[model samples]
Target chain A: MYRYDEFDHAFVQTRVAQFREQVEARLAGQLTEEEFRPLRLMNGLYLQLHAYMLRIAIPYGTLSARQMRQLAFITDRFDRGSAHFTTRQNLQLNWPKLIETPDILAALAEVEMHGIQTSGNCIRNVTSDQYAGVAADEIEDPRPTGELIRQWSTDHPEFSFLPRKFKIAVTGAAMDRAAVAAHDIGIRVVRNDAGEVGYRIYVGGGLGRTPMLARLVREFLPKDDLIAYLEAIMRVYNLFGRRDNKYKARVKILMHEAGTETVKRMVEEEFARLPRAAINVDPAELARIEAYFAPPAYEALGDEPALLAAARQADAGFDAFARANVVAHKQPGYAIVNISLKPIGGAPGDATSAQMRAVADLSERYGFGEIRVTHAQNLVLPDVRQRDLPALYRELLAAGLGDANAGLITDIIACPGMDYCSLATARSIPIAKAIAQRFANPARQQLIGELGIKISGCINACGHHHLGGIGILGLEKGGEESYQITLGGDPGNDAAIGKLLGPGLAGDDVPDAIERIVDLYLAGREAGETFVAAYRRLGHDHFKGALNADRH
Target chain B: MPIVTERGFGPDGWATVADETAVADGGDVIVSWKRFVAEAATLTGRAGRIGVAVGPDFDVDLHVAGLDGVALVAIAFAKFADGRGFSIARRLRDRGFAGTIRAVGPLIAEQAPMAFACGIDEIAIPDDLAARQPESRWLRAVELRAAVSYQRGYRTGASVFDQRSTGGAA
Candidate 1:
């Protein structure tokens, strides 16, 4: 929600110009491919399996209607009329020409957006809860802090080339919707017993080949020392993190190798050496950033349960959608509507240009002209009124964006896998489609309840398979696609890495394998227990037997 | 082997002299930190000012206290992408080392702004790169509006917040 100030505008413009020159240099053979690779990556241009992919950063997953419209325009003109929303709360244009990337970046800058730091070994786009300012349980919005960090890390001289890529996620609510625990650095906004607000910092958490939850490095860091503290952590990691092996270069590995206590001591020593006041942003600037996320205008309407009930009774389809997709908002009479990108038999996070424009229009007309991108690759109209729900639903249904299966079995989180990514060992999209088709019924989904089935093409875990309640990791075994299952993993307040269940199965048999696991959950769940809770009660042995049931 | 500064191309002010070999020429010669430590007394009476060149692993703080007699400090990049030398330059500047800081590497013109911003007085690039990139590109790169960088003490760039505080608008 923070608009670009003059400095931000100038910064982006200068970067665009800089990249344009770099691209020209590459084309003219003035710079070799090796020299240009990192430069291109820093601007979010990746030479994927088939074509170049340009990832555009959506700062903290927040966007205005105008910005969405601009994205739709970019999709229509530059790409093949479709865009993929990534698990990191950003969008990727999968089929852009290498020559036209500068133009694409320039267009994004016009809408106060760009692909800066979306890739490469520098600090990535900072992420936060999609429901940041609107969530009922939020203590404070994390977007301001996220934006502040974004500014601090962009083109940072000391950290431009790190040992490896770094990720940071912030969460304002007690519920960790931003997947903070699985990031390089996680900041949970908290208040002390005396009511003074601060941060609880976590370091070295990541989900790659080796997934590890971040350790709490600082129990309570004063808000003023945020930048200085992060500088200390980065400096220590840059100086000592392993460069011998690419796989072992992450800060998490350093924490694992040297012990968290040693890393913490080093960071504390570095932090003590720096002048905190000189390094940190003025508190007034943070306040200025916070003001941009203040609640929009709302009428004095009371609770809308009765109105919503009446509308639901009139239309069963509307009722199912309202029941599943609508979440409680902090403001009265306003509801948070999640527009599912994962429809039955469709690729997990792909959206057409038309669907994007429709969502933009809906955001402007029904909501407060704002839209949010979720980590689960869904769109959210964060401030829709209860009275306008039916009308918005009709518009959404017509555009084929009316999936009533949010947080249900049909709403799968999947990476692009073998289809688009060169790193993928197996295809994840087809498996996601098969499972969604298997559980397509609304009643069946509602009965199954809050199940997150996340699929990643490879161990890089781009789809966040490590955090799903039902995580499916796709791999290759002797030239054939093999699917592996994990259970009880969560990305919330009590974050835990999922337990691996038995051996890999053929790609064709994955749907049935997931079905068998679901059947076990259905048979064993206690009253009011979610899939994760059911799995915790039953354990991996309970599901391992179910995995081989069909073979028997 | 051309060295460039903001002022322009100039005669090589400092020469790299071997540690054990004694030179009658003044302090214009640059020696390794190890050599500077081992041969300080003998090198102190030279006519030209003495400079010290450090590798990427050299601790700037370890030598900061003894910088009164040193006129210049040169840090090597070894590889263009390794940015540790920039941090060293900044640390030296922050610790009040008021001398000419040179960055030795195969860095191109694009990295000139970042090098200067981190407090490097000049970039002593390899002779081949100097021919390929040329001095005009370096001058153009250094004159970029990078002074509007976002970080506070990383550079003397006017921060967005500072601009706001001074009543500038987007």
Candidate 2:
């Protein structure tokens, strides 16, 4: 994990002081609520339905034990005793009072964290693979790139007030855990034929009322030209992106309106005009950031220790957990343990203060003192030893963190919808809960196998419903909550937006409709085929009748 | 309207003429983009220095060639949230405009640093906004944000990239 240097510390503190003054001005009536809204939003403060929601950026989803503890302390002190981990790998405190937000920010800054650029129409928190350096298929660690972007985009003079919010995600691994396709800018770290590391840049991808997958603007961008090229793209968007309609203000709409080739030409022209030598960071600076993400010290050991196998054989629960929650690591004798926050019938990503503290302690005791928040609304211990699986599993069980459903149907991604969000037109948490309860049986979930059911309460798509294997979007139709289903959306290399299935159904009819679709998939799938793969093979026509079961 | 520059509040040096207003002689005057383009032949040899007030949608590339003797370029922000003016300033500087760049709008004091960094030499704010947020607030904002910035190529004493490359404070 990256530690805050003196400069980083001072930067965050200064921002905190700046925000403190802004809050005072707002309270003193020197600044109107309309004027203060953007300032507060830039600091990641939002006025939700019930209270102020302060979102804290967990840069690249990596957190040290100390930082996790600080988050727990903040949750206990200012907010209710829990926090929700967003799909962007950030955390949201839903109950923080507006007056106490500055204090909360100061506390976060103490742990090398702040809420800057987590919201508002600026370059948001740069996200990358949760398993950046540890993943087996990585070409290069992307945290350094993400960090460089973080520094460059922080209070960026030229891009602070963009036409609309901009999101940039980077993925170093071939697997694309960060869902780079559904971002405003997506960078995939790749190596050229000559073995020189570069980037495959994608632009214009976003999901909101209008969902768009990014187009490849640059096939190969040298690593050194990263910042300069990004500046060119942002400059082009800031100048030309539409501002008349807020819905059509994203960079995607610009790329869609102005053809990709035209946007590319504009970006290349801008890139040519920019002073690249001065804009790009020095190689030594990149190397300095990269050093922080080097592989941790590991003992000399072979793969899959004997004890792990024996423990799995002895307990069915342990066997299920190892099969679902654990993933292979690049280093030997290590496994990436995903602690699912999507417990059956519970809110998708809410973690109690006790759960947070326990996970922090487990990170210190079992692995290195580091934790990762996954984009799927889960927590990851990226360096857990295979030998410690049993003990770690038992401790996780005691803390209610031992859910053996990582990519299963029960592990759903949902937004804090009508329960707290002012923008929500329908409730999402209840839908997610109902679906999870429907598939609560472990054997049934294993049979369903690797199906993602994402639910969003509104068209804002905060839960990333468009990327789910079974995408469920909630809307208000005819004065009743309606759920619409989309199938075959994948967030990986073969990224595609899901196709909408028939007409929308009532809220109570959603789970049964999902079950019908799953039944069709099970009956149609070939041997060892995942839901998305089967959907591709069987096509949308095969599952079109599933939603119409009740219509007849 | 009050103008805010690097040296706090400054006196307005030019008169802004509407598109329909007559261009008087013997004083610096700013005019709309429409007037600049329509009367470029006559305004070039006029007695007064000419400045152009452009909207957020103004394309500097299309008009940069005609701005040879222009003394100032005033970019307007129809709304404070409309940021196209910032890009307009950057483009003017990129096109080798050696004259003063002014931003005119209802921008808050907190936006002073960004406006200055984007090559705006001064900001002419609406009277209502100037009354609410005085010059002291704007000066404090600029001073506080001038301490450190990671971006390069802009006017800043402390560039994080430069500091890292030169082995200054981390």
Cα lDDT of candidate 2 equals: 0.91
Q: Candidate 2, A130: how far from true, in Å?
A: 1.2
Model 2 C-alpha lDDT per residue in residues A115-230, reported as the tens digit of each score: 99999999999999988889999999999999999999999888988999999999999899999999999999999999999999999999999999999999999998999999
DockQ of 2: 0.71
TM-score of each: 0.96, 0.99
Deviation in Å, model 1, residue A319 alpha carbon: 2.6
lDDT of 1 by residue, A1-552 (tens): 798887888888888888898898888876778778888999999989999999999989999999999999999999999999999989999999988989999999999999989998889999999999999999999999999999889888778777889999999997899989899999999999889899999999999899999999999999999999999899888777877787898899999999999999989987987777778888888998999888888888777888889999999999999988999999888899999999999999999999999999999998889999999999999999889999999999999999999889889999999999989999999999999999998999999999999999999999899999999999988888888888989999889899888788888888898888899999999998999998888877888876775441
Clash pairs (backbone) in predicted model 2: none
Interface RMSD of 2: 1.4
